[model samples]
Target chain A: MMNKKTAPVGVFDSGVGGLTVAREISRQLPDENIVYFGDTARVPYGSKSQNTIIRFSEQIIRFLKTKEVKAIVIACNTASALALDAVKDEFDIPILGVVIPGARAAVEATKNRKVGVVGTEATVQSGMYTKVIQGMNPEITVIEKACPLFVPLVEEGFKEHQVTEEVIEYYLESMRSTDIDAMILGCTHYPLLRSKIRAYMGDKIQIVNPAYETAMDLKCLLEENDMANDGTEGQHSNYSFYVSDAAEKFRKFANTVMPFDVPITNVVNIEGY
Target chain B: MMNKKTAPVGVFDSGVGGLTVAREISRQLPDENIVYFGDTARVPYGSKSQNTIIRFSEQIIRFLKTKEVKAIVIACNTASALALDAVKDEFDIPILGVVIPGARAAVEATKNRKVGVVGTEATVQSGMYTKVIQGMNPEITVIEKACPLFVPLVEEGFKEHQVTEEVIEYYLESMRSTDIDAMILGCTHYPLLRSKIRAYMGDKIQIVNPAYETAMDLKCLLEENDMANDGTEGQHSNYSFYVSDAAEKFRKFANTVMPFDVPITNVVNIEGY
Candidate 1:
């Protein structure tokens, strides 16, 4: 049996956008093994309903459990916002979602007590970010907007295109005019368009990426739980990727953004779980 | 028992985009009942692999078969390009895809023997349109480009927005410079952006909508098979809509673009099939 301390950490998202979170985890915890799953077959969960997102997250967690993961990270913001509460307790392992970490960071970064959040339709509709931020500090005001086109723009590989700049201006026109001192890139895909968004929002507004905060939180959770891999077991850290759809496209995208070369990717029929 | 002549025609798409085809069918075949299924849960099949697209298309077709549909229309361009051939002969009923009709219309409309096609990534990669057009006339040339962002732009309700026009210009710049006399709005959702596309392409090029061509083809098939509904049985023509995800969003979108009111929509677990 694999030692619980040496077992891999499981991370999942609706699709490849969660790679941003996975990359942060790899950077923060270099000694830990990571098993990542992307449900590329039914991606962009930001526009889906609460019930569907919850169901998908549960299935992914169940699949990760079969891999004997010590901890799990709900890397996709939409899933983190809508599904984490419903599935977090169903499993015994420490499970962390990006929403709380993101909210906390947004609260800390804001000087004007006003924060802006841009995410998918479902994430904004759930009001998860605003709820968590206000729950921490009632005086803080949260301005939420759903930028449904960002994921498609990133997925279409238009992150640096002129039209993407135009799209950013179009969606953030109202948010830019506000007094918010910090803005949260609420969707995992948005981080890929960070330069464009930052360019449009300017230097006055700080940008918060939940991927970084979620990785920090995961590190603390492992340390407190005594589950951190210490590199004494003669086990070398390894990274494995699995997606619900074709691995070629995912592998190509991952290689361009991932910290390490993604040579092999596995395909899993997620619907069966 | 439902009479063969009175059975509703089944039309299916990855999502609500197929409503364009459904509306066209209603206009051309006024006496016929219709069954429309949108796989909203696993939508935008444009970027997915051929095998996954085929599996999803099969599940949807099986679900529609339970509705006792006389014939099926693969209203989604991605599915029509990738999945139609694999599943068409598997079912006893006639299954028609939009690719052939769209390609035929482009061939007829183009006087310069050159045509342009725009669709989802899967549809363009499938080369179904190019193959069909070139097969009809070896001398003709087919220029294909995948406008993956168009679907999301339309879904985001940016049909009349200026950013859409910019995106249109970006995607069609090279095509506009070409001498292709006819351009096919190959994807079903594309009809919503017809005005923007027309304005960009200018008056020199003719635009072909596969929805209209597919509807005309269906009319011919029904007449040839003597399966046209004559309303002689006093069975009032009715339309029913079903989706794989939450019905509320689908109902709202359908109400906006559909010719008739979508009073009630049902949700189906498409994975169960």
Candidate 2:
């Protein structure tokens, strides 16, 4: 049997947006086991209140702890902005949020030192990006736009719809005026709207998606902590999913978002935990 | 004090979209008190799975029951489509789902017996409109397009932007080909987009909003059941709000949508109750 040190890394989001991060993690760390939980039942945490999002995050982290995860990744941007600080205090394990990773990446990607951000209203209003960016590079100027509709558009599978394009155009119009060289997709779901947003914003604006960068950061954290899975020949890593509500939709969404299929289960009642 | 029977009616939606319905209810029954709950914590129920939406609806209804609501109105179209039956069975009070009321209105409003419908994916997929409209008038031809982005746009408060107009044009273009005589704003948030929709669909297409009709229905039900708040001299009614998430955002949204301000409170952890 493989050593217990190869315990799975737990990741969770309000819905499928986390899959973007999960997929990146899977690709970058093929040897490590991954466990994902999508709160498909009660999604769109972006619009929810700080306290409510914190409570929900606590429940999800507690459930993940039961699985003995080595570390946790708050793949949802809303959770990252509102709940990450409180979560780090309550839990002993190391937790990584998508914001800083994306922020750092945006800093590196921007040539003009002027950046734009698009996320859910809560995330945008929290000024998380502005604070994070300015903390690292005080010279950089940040403009933030809340593309609240992007999440719903993505969830409804309007990935390529013309209306989606128009909506993205509407949301990005504010950014275009700022002459931003890079735009950080502050919401996990915003990445799905990449092509549409890019088409409207044109090729000049470099879009920074945190999911990929977060995956890289997770790998670095694992190696630095000596928690990376050891080579166990003939053993393949698998992913299991748990959702607060509606396992079936989570399963279907899992198939749609990620390249590989994973087993998804519905807990229905998270408060029970 | 007025008799306890004149207690405020409880209304809820996944988010601020229900404000449209709430506004109508307040306008029609000026003297009646209202208690509104916007599950701003986990909004955009249209994209979630049926079972998860049911759970959310159940939790919101349970919360409303604690308020001792005289009647419950689900001002959200997604809940009306997916959770209405389950909610009706779970609670004994006069529970009204917006689907039937809206469908009935659409059937009545169409001059050419040709109607178009636009809403979230779940609302359109549920076929609730087809079933309800056919039951009312079998000969009426219903053309449905799931304009999923509309909810987020309304929530984001982009009701009158150029991009909003573009999005409306893109979404309503489908209705133009069908020559729809009436277009039902299937989602509660949709009525907020009525001006844009009306502009796109032109004067020939009658716009049907269930929020308006539902308010009317509530008045009739209250009067018939002898639960109407007496509008006699020296009578004043008040409203209290409970949201699953941000009290601040809900308060701001309430002020914008309601004719007058009402008190709002955040119920921190009411899920699964």
Docking class of 1: high
- All candidates' lDDT scores? 0.91, 0.83
lDDT tens string, model 1, B58-149? Answer: 89899999999989999999999998999987888889999999989988999989999999888899898999899898888999999989
Report residue B217 deviation for candidate 2 (angstroms).
2.3
> For candidate 1, lDDT tens digit of each residue in A193-263?
88888888999999999999999999999999899998897776899999999898899999988977996
Real contacts recovered, all predictions: 0.90, 0.82
True contacts kept of 2: 0.82
Q: Which digits, one per residue and each the tens of the lDDT, describe model 2 over residues A32-66?
A: 88888888767778877777788889999988888
Model 2 docking tier (incorrect/acceptable/medium/high): medium
Chain A, model 2: TM: 0.96
Model 1 chain B: which ten-residue window has the lowest total lDDT? B254-263
